[model samples]
Target: MSNRVINILVPVISILLGLLVGAIVMLFSGYDPVNGYIALWNGIFGDSYAIGETIRQISPYILAGLAVAFAFRTGLFNIGVEGQLMVGWFAAVYVGAAFELPMIIHLPITLLAAALAGALWGLVPGILKATLRVHEVIVTIMMNYVALHVVNALIKTVSNGSYKTEKIQPTASLRSDFLSNLTDYSTLHYGIFVALAMVIVMWFILEKTKTGFELKSVGFNENASQYAGMNVKKNIVLSMVISGAFAGLAGAMEGLGTFGSMTSLGGFTGIGFDGIAVALLGANTPLGVIFGASLFGSLKYGANNMPNAANIPLEIVSIVVALIIFFVASGYIIRVGLQRLKKKKEAK
Candidate 1:
C-alpha cells in the first residue's frame, strides 16, 4: 500500500478501535452502548443549535491544536500554550475594555494585542531553548503557573474585588447577530470564520511557503539543516513565535467571542492541554487538526446530554476520548501491522 493510504487507514482504524473498546466497556458496566452513542449523536447533530454549539466549542480547539502542531512540526515542545493563552486572553480583554474606537480599528487592535502577547509569551521559552539550552517543556510548564498567578493578581487589582474584568466595548466584540440568529441564539460567533481562515493560512504556510520548508527541515534534522547553511536556532525561535501567535488567537476567541470579558481562574482552562491530544490525534497537520477538533468538540458537547439520557457517568465519555487518544498515540503499531499485511499481499 502507498504511504498516503497507510496514513489515512491508521487514523481511521484507531478511531474504530477506540469506539469498539468504548462500547465494550460500556456494555460491561451495564450500560447500553447503543443508546449512549445515540444520545451523543443526537446531542451533536439532532438540531441546528447542537450543531452550532459543537462548532463554537471546537473553533478554539482548532487554533490550539494548530499551535501545538505548528511547534511539533518545527521540532519544539511548547507546553506553554496554556500560559500563552491566558496572557493573550487578558491582553485582549484589557485592550477591549480600556479603549474605545471604531470597529474597524478596535477589533483588529484587540486581536493583534492577543497575538502579540501570546507570541511574546512563547518567545521567552524559545529563546531559552536556543540560547541557554534549556528544556522548553520544563520552562513552559513553570511559566504556566507564573502566568496564572500574575494574571490572577492583575485581574484582582483591577476588578474592584471581582474575579473578572468588565465587559469589553461593543466594537471589540466578535459576536455576530446573523450567526446567532441562524444558530438559534447559540454561542456561535464570528470567531469561527477567523478560526477557519487561520486553518487555511496554516495550510498554505506549511505546504506552500519557503519559511515553512525551513521550519520543517529543522524539525526533521537540526544538525543536517545547520550543515546545509540554514539558521536552525533562528528557525526554532521563529517557529515558537508563530505557534504562540496561533494560541493567542485562540484566547481571543474566548475573550472576544465567547465571554467578552476576562475572568480570574483558580486553575488552568485545560484547552491548551487538550491541544496536545488534538495535535497527536491529528498527526500534527493543519487539515487533520480540524477533523480531530471536530471529533473532540462533538464528544464534549455530547457528553453533557449523555448522563441525563443514558444514566451513565460523564467520565465514560472522557474514558472513551482518552482511549481514542491512546490508540492514536500508538499508531506505529498499526502502521507495522499494515506493512506486514501489504507484504503478504505483494508476495501473493
Candidate 2:
C-alpha cells in the first residue's frame, strides 16, 4: 500500500512480465526460452572465465550509468554523454601513447586527461543551455557528431593516418591476473577498481556535499535556486561537467581496460545512449545505477554465450532489456494501478 511497497512490487512484476513476453516471442519465433536463458546464464555466470567477462562488461557501464544518472538528478537531459565519452576515450588514448612513464604515474595521468576531455565536452552543452538557452537534448545530439569526427581525425593523426592509435605503454594498461587465465587471456583489468572508486566518489558528492545540493536545487527550479542565492548558472555548468567527466572515465576504462588502443569510429559508441536506459532503470541513484549497469552488462556478456550454448538468437537479451525499460518508463501507470488497488482495499 505504501509507495516503497509499490516501488518494490513494480520492479518484480515488471521482470516477470518481461520474461513472459520473451517466452511468447521465443515460442512464436520457433525458439525455446528456457534453453536461451540457460545458455545466457552459463555464458555470464557458468565459470570463472564467464564471471570475469561479466565484470569486464560491467566496468564501463558503471561510468556510463553514472554519467546519465548525475545528469538526470540535476534535471537535465544530457544526450551528449556518447560524444563526451568519445572525446575522453580519444584524449586518454592519445595521451597514453604520447607518453612513457612509470605505471603508477602514467596510468593516472592518462585517465585524468580523459575525465578533463569529457568535462570540456559536457561544458559546451551546459553553456548553451545556460547562456544561449539551447535545449540540451539538441545540443548534446549535435555534439555527438562533432565528438565522433574529432576523435576520428585525432585517431587518424595519431596513428599516422591509420584508423587506430598506437598501443599505450604497457604501464598504462590496467592489470589483472585471475582474469588473464580466463577469457583466453582476455582484456579484463584493474579498471573495475577505477569504476568502483568513481561510484563511491559520485555517491559522496551527491549525498554529502553542498555542491550536490546546489545542483539538485537548480535541477528542481533554476529560478528558485537563483532567488535563494544559489549560483544556478555555475551549478548548471558544473552538473554537465561532472556528468561528462563520469562518461569520460567510462571511455578511458574501455580504451585502457578492453581495447588497449584507439580506433576511428564511424559514429557514437552507443554505450552513452545505453546510459540513459541505465539511469532511468536505476531511478537515477548511484546504487540503482550500479545494479542497472550490472544487469545490462550481464545480458550483454551472456548474449554471445546464448547462441553458442543454447542454440538461441542473441536478440533475446535485448528483448528482455527492452521490456524492462518499457515498464520503468511507464512508472506513472504503475502508480495509478497501485492507487486503484489501495482504494478497493480501503473499501473492503
Candidate 3:
C-alpha cells in the first residue's frame, strides 16, 4: 500500500479494533454491546440537544488539540498546556467579571487577556529551552503545578476564600441565545465559531506562511535551520507562544462559553492532557484534529447514556476510549504490518 493509504487505514483499523475489543469486553461482562452502542449513538445524534452538546464539547477539544498539534509539529513537548490553560481561564474570567464595558469591547478584551496569559505561561518553557538548554517537557510539567497553585491562590484571594468566582458580566459572555434556542436549550454557543476560525488560522500558518516554514524547518533540523540563517531559538519560542495561544482560546471557551466563571482547581483540567491524545490520533494536522476532536467529543457526550440504557458500567466507555488511544499510539506497528502485506502482494 502507498504511504497515504497506510496512513488512512491505520486510524481506521485502530478504531475498528478498539470498538471490537470494547464489544468483547461488554459481552464478557454480560452487557449487550448492541444496546450500548445504540444508546451511545442516540446520545450523540438522537436529537437537537445531543448534537448541540456534542458541538459545544467539540469546540474546546478542537482548540486544545490544535495547541498540542502545533507544538508537536515544532518538535516541542508542551506538557504545560494544562497550566497555560488554567491561567488563561483565570485571566479570561477575571477580565470578564471585573470589567463593565460594551459587548464589542469587553469580549475581545477578555479573550485577549486569556491568550496573553497562556502565551506568558508557555514563554517560560520556551525561554528555558532556548537559552538555558533545559528540557521543555520537564519545565512544562513543573509549570503545570505552579500554574495550578497560582490560579488557586488568585481565585481564593479574590473570592475571599471561596473556590469559585462570580459569573462573568453579560457583555463578556460568548453564549448565543439563538444557538441555545435552536438546539433545544443546549449549551452551544458562539465559541464553536471561534474554535473553527482558529483551526483555519493554524492550517494557513503551517501550510502557507514563511514563518511557519522556518518553525517546521527548525523542528526538522535545528542545525540545518541555523546554518540556513533561520532564527531557530526565536522560532522555538514563537511556536510555544502560538501553541499556548490556542490552548488559551480553549480556556476562553470554558470560562466565557460553558461555565461563565472560574473555579479553583486542585488538579489539571484534563482537556490539555486529552489534547495530547487528540494530537496523536489526529496525526498532528489541523483537519485531522477537527475529526479527532469530534470523535472524542461524541464519546464523551454519549458515555453517560450507556449505563442507563444498556445496563453497562460507565467504565466500559472509558475502556473503549482508552483502547482507541492505545491503538493510535501503536500505529507504527500497523504501518509495518501493512508494508509486509504490500511486499507479499508484490512478490505474488
Each model's RMSD to truth, in Å? 1.8, 2.1, 1.8
Any runs in candidate 1 off by more than 4 Å, and if so which?
A: 1-9
lDDT of 3 by residue, 91-209 (tens): 99999999899999999999999999999999989998989889999999999899999999999998999999989999999999999999999999999999999999999999999
lDDT of each residue in 1-348, candidate 1, tens digit only: 988999889888987897789889889888998998888788899788888888899988998999999999889999899999899999999999999999999999999999999999999999988888899999899988998999999898888888989999999999988888898888899888888899998889889999999999999998999999999889989998999999999999999999999889989999988888878778899988998888777877877877888888977877866776678678889999999999999999
Q: TM-scores of all models? A: 0.94, 0.93, 0.94
The candidate that wins on lDDT is: 3
Q: After superposition, how far is residue 12 of candidate 1 from its true place, in Å?
A: 3.4
- Clash pairs of candidate 3? none
lDDT-best of 1 and 3: 3
Q: After superposition, how far is residue 142 of candidate 3 from its true place, in Å?
A: 0.8
